[model samples]
Target: MTTRVATETFPMPDGSLGARLTMTAGRANSLEPGLLGDLASALDEAEAQDTSAILICGGRNFSSGGDVRAFHRASLDGEAVAYANAVVPRLQAIVGRLIAMPRLVVVAARGAVTGGSAGLLFAADLAVLAPDAFVQPYYAKVGFAPDGGWTALLPERIGAGRTLEWLQSDRRLDASALCDAGLATAVSDTPEMTAARLAAEGEIGTRLATKALVWDEARRARINARLEAETAAFLERIVQPDTALGMSRFIERIGS
Candidate 1:
């Protein structure tokens, strides 16, 4: 009821239920102020319903990250700071929630996952990427400091040294590379089905218990603290003239 699409409940391995949330709004599933909060609320709904696993299927594309075109417009209007203020905190909350979510969190990544991108994609218990899917970081090119857990959750998933080097370079992490880096759990033509099948393999209660132990309050606190740090740096950079210029050029380069 909270999302653009209906929540489809599925069968989990232990005969409990699972929920599937499909995102479909804006081009390439671009992030919107309302949509982000709605999705987060949808997760709340699923959790309230006691769903053991939740599958997020991003329609067409996983996401083009935050709406750069919108950001570009905000820059032109000198309201980029306000726009970012509106967007980032909500996004950060969802990413943090996923980090310590008791029920399994899964993302079905289909097209491009770019920009500071969806930290939730990386934050998920499992990300099943479509074979042709790719994730790229455009923060350097856009002159934006990484938000959405680029520096936070990612280093936790990959590694600190590698994350730094990777961020500095211009590269696309294709599904294969994503798997090899341990960012994605698997790559398949049908990512939703893949996620569903994976979700059906374990005893939900026991798995959730282990999740609680591993993603403990201490770990959750660390992740939240790091996310807050990213938010601070991001707000500082997004208001700068250089980042406004970068946003302009990047949007023109992409012809959007």
Candidate 2:
């Protein structure tokens, strides 16, 4: 997995900067540890540059969720407990950085955004999905609970009842539907254009100042506490017999 940060400068005299970071993988840029480290480095640079806004997306699918192959390996190797301890907490911390970033964070999703990717979408201040893009919480289908702050963030965008239904089922939602549900700000023809539009809509000075204030107040300590709880619950689901059963059933259903 590789995380490449691209900096595109607009003619904004307002001193606000914007960047787009693409987390890429060899095949499916599943959320591997090295990928996460690369992302953290990119975020550090973005923060240092004092970017007014940041966009997170992928080359193809925003992510196929976590590397299923990695999960499968970990389970078979009996490393689930150790892997969960090391990875889940780091994931939660990275997500914390995202949520607490001073500027508005936009997710430009172009394809099927599932699993942990879905959780990252929830961390966004705004999300722009391609018209044909699909998004869903696919954890339960894979025999796991929600992670990537989905439990904490989903209900904030969609109603609690709806969030529950989505989490419990294997339904897929298109970009337009996500926009209608307030999970996404709009649907774009392309992720690049979406990033450009968001950049154009802002004056650097004002965007930066406003974003800082928003992050400060909006991300109270309670939010972090909730995020930690969410991660813990998600990890617990990994070893549950029901989760294993659900995963097997899902795999068979999908003919995978």
Candidate 3:
């Protein structure tokens, strides 16, 4: 409904189908609920009409995570429960949609992905992180446990021990390290060249059809399972001291 959730479908310079999330706010293109729903609809449309794989990219800095300004405003009124009930479910739905998208979903990560954005990258089928790109999941850094299916999806990609380390460390993961940790498919020194090549391969009908049949259903189910599993973990963690401390430290660190 809101034009803020813009979807532009155009042929890539190399002839692939590309989907650009068109709202730019600061270095982080933080998505609102409307934008997330619009993205899901756009993907569904593209899935029905275009057999070409979809490329998800952003305006400037990919995505910097949850709109902390929005979150903070909600928290300011001492209505923490209201904020959690409203925001977290929408975030989870977005994660589910990203995971269930029935095409070869590729992410072109140019800069930083934090919060829910990082979770989306983890669920993507193929992700190419630019050499300078970084990733941070800020849930633990805040006063909450992981949401957006992060608990389930992160462990699958980076393993439980390492996932715990990454979350607990409150550090940023550069593109190369992400690739090495198995979180990303590749790290692209030349993002343009890599994106171009992927576009070429993506435009092929055979690839899309093959992916739709082989990977879509299976991956979606896996992601759904992960979401449920992670939600439980998150609910439990939210009541723990460690999670509260982690969140407090993250909030203070970010503010100062």
Give me the candidate number with maximum lDDT: 1
lDDT tens digits, residue span 1-256, model 3: 3454455665654454666444444436775655565666766667766535566776557787666555555555554445555556666776776655555667777887877678778767677878889987766556566777667677766678988887788788899888887767777865534654675554456655765665467766886776766655655555556654565566677673
What lDDT does the true structure give each of the candidates? 0.83, 0.72, 0.65
Best by TM-score: 1
Model 1, runs deviating above 4 Å: 1-5
lDDT (tens digit, per residue) of candidate 2 on 1-256: 4244344434334556677787776545667776766777888888888776787878667777766556656766777767666566666777777777776677888887887667778778778888768987777667776777776766666768998888787689898888788888887788667666776575656765775665565564656787789777867887777866676676567564
In candidate 3, how many Å is residue 215 off?
Answer: 5.0
Candidate 1 TM-score, true structure as reference: 0.95
**Ten-residue region with minimum lDDT total, candidate 2:** 2-11
Given candidate 1, what's the lDDT at residue 62?
A: 81
| Candidate 1 residue-wise lDDT, 1-256, digit = tens | 3455457798775777899988777777676787787788788889998898999888778888888788878877888889988888888888888877788888888888886555868788888999889988888889778888988888877789888887899488899998999888998999999989998887777777987887789878887898999988888998888988888888789894
Q: Which scores greater on lDDT, model 1 or model 3?
A: 1
**How many clashing residue pairs, candidate 1?**
0
Q: What is the alpha-carbon lDDT of model 3 when measured against the actual structure?
A: 0.65
| Clashing residue pairs found in predicted model 3 | 142-247, 143-247
Q: What is the lDDT of residue 138 in candidate 1?
A: 82
Count clashing residue pairs per candidate: 0, 0, 2
